[model samples]
Target: MNATETFDWAAAGESLAESVTLIAGGARGTGRTAALSLLQLGARVAIVDLDPGRIATVAEDFAEYGTDRVFTAVADCTVREDVQAAAAATAEHFGKLTHCVYSAGAYRAQRPTLDIGADEWDLIVDSNLKGAFLTYQAVIPHLQRAGGGALVSISSLAGRTSSPFLGCHYTAAKAGILGLTRHLAKEFGPSNIRANAVCPGGVVGTRMNDLLSELHREQDLVELAKQTPLGRNVHEPDVVGAILFLLSDLSRFVTGATIDVNGGILTI
Candidate 1:
């Protein structure tokens, strides 16, 4: 049969209908948007965040889906026990886990390399890079149990190139995510698992935006947009779309790939 005759476009739409996804840092920002988008696609969602208040707020926000379809846990991704428990609880609650989106990360006001302290460096690295490592460690077994699964990590355009608005530590941690994702893809390919990363540039209305607003004027963002071929910064949905594609069967053979969602900025 030809490719067109063999392709099931309807199946692609229902790819995630049976998925049970765990979204780290799903309380707000791109992670939160991903959770809502997945829920709309008929997937069961489990969201984990460090803040108890934020977890509760997201739980309420997802209440429309009812308890059977949604789960929420308070977890600090940097802590091994916390991440392990959350992952275990999610699989136990939902009966099986199929996908994970490791979106939990941190950033600080831009600082020079010489001015960055050890404590600050540790905080950023542990929060962004180490947290992703721990989350994958915790979720891999559950993915294995389900026979096969997908993992998507949120890297930054800073990971690919230097960031003008973030510190070196943030950039370093984001870069680490890319390397880690590639390693996971190679190591787990034999087990029918896939791993990928998404690198977004200057997403607006996110926590990063709030931080950048304090550091640079609105004009700076406009100037940055003008440099992009698309003439606009990324939005929450743009990053979420790339993530959803990675999670769905539409990208079944796509692994160890980094999808750039930067509105044509920083193309390689």
Candidate 2:
């Protein structure tokens, strides 16, 4: 039997069957999709978001998963207390936390560096970078108590290169996430915790896509897709698959690494 025949494809998802995952900024978009996928894999999930309405709506979406396996917390990821509280609540509700996914970030309209205001920079940086820091800080201890875990941070292709549709602030924040993820992987590896990053290109159905649609002509969008080796922009599932891999034991020995889900648009 070769590697292919020996591989247990059906057991690939079983590694996460006992997982308890917390998704920061999980109310919508890729984060929301991740939550649903985790639940489907037989893992318990806790969703933390800044908006109560989104929390309610996503909770409804997960209603079939039942209350025992799903938890929701409404808190601002940028606030230390809120994030700590949410992490604590998640652990208390789920019994343990085995994985964390930081998908909370913001993007603003494209503008020249000179035209970008200080406030806008601060907001974007704090939301994308500081929020990840806080979420990691709050969850790391819980993971420690649980013996070990994994962390997956959602960065962007903009961080790897540049964004034609967003400002420098978004780029900087996402780039910061890559750095933070590496540092966490180094700092926590001794504790058995793993950390990795996923950089996805312009994903369809995301707010970034909405902004792109508004800013670029149809031909421009087509041109953008044509540039990628895959001949299309990334979709939610493309990124979610990467997230699920990092969260599962399949990536047990993989840490301090980056998996780009950018359809080969920007290869290093």
On residues 167-194, what C-alpha lDDT tens digit does candidate 2 reach at each position?
Answer: 8999989999999989999999999999
TM-score of each: 0.96, 0.94
For each candidate, the alpha-carbon lDDT, in order, equals 0.91, 0.90
Clashing pairs in 1: none
TM-score of 1: 0.96
Indicate which candidate wins on lDDT.
1
Model 1, residue 267: distance off in Å is 1.0
lDDT tens digits, residues 185-245, model 1? 9999988799999999988886866876788666778888889898887889999999989
Candidate 1's displacement at residue 114, Å, is 0.7
RMSD of candidates 1 onward, in order? 1.8, 2.9
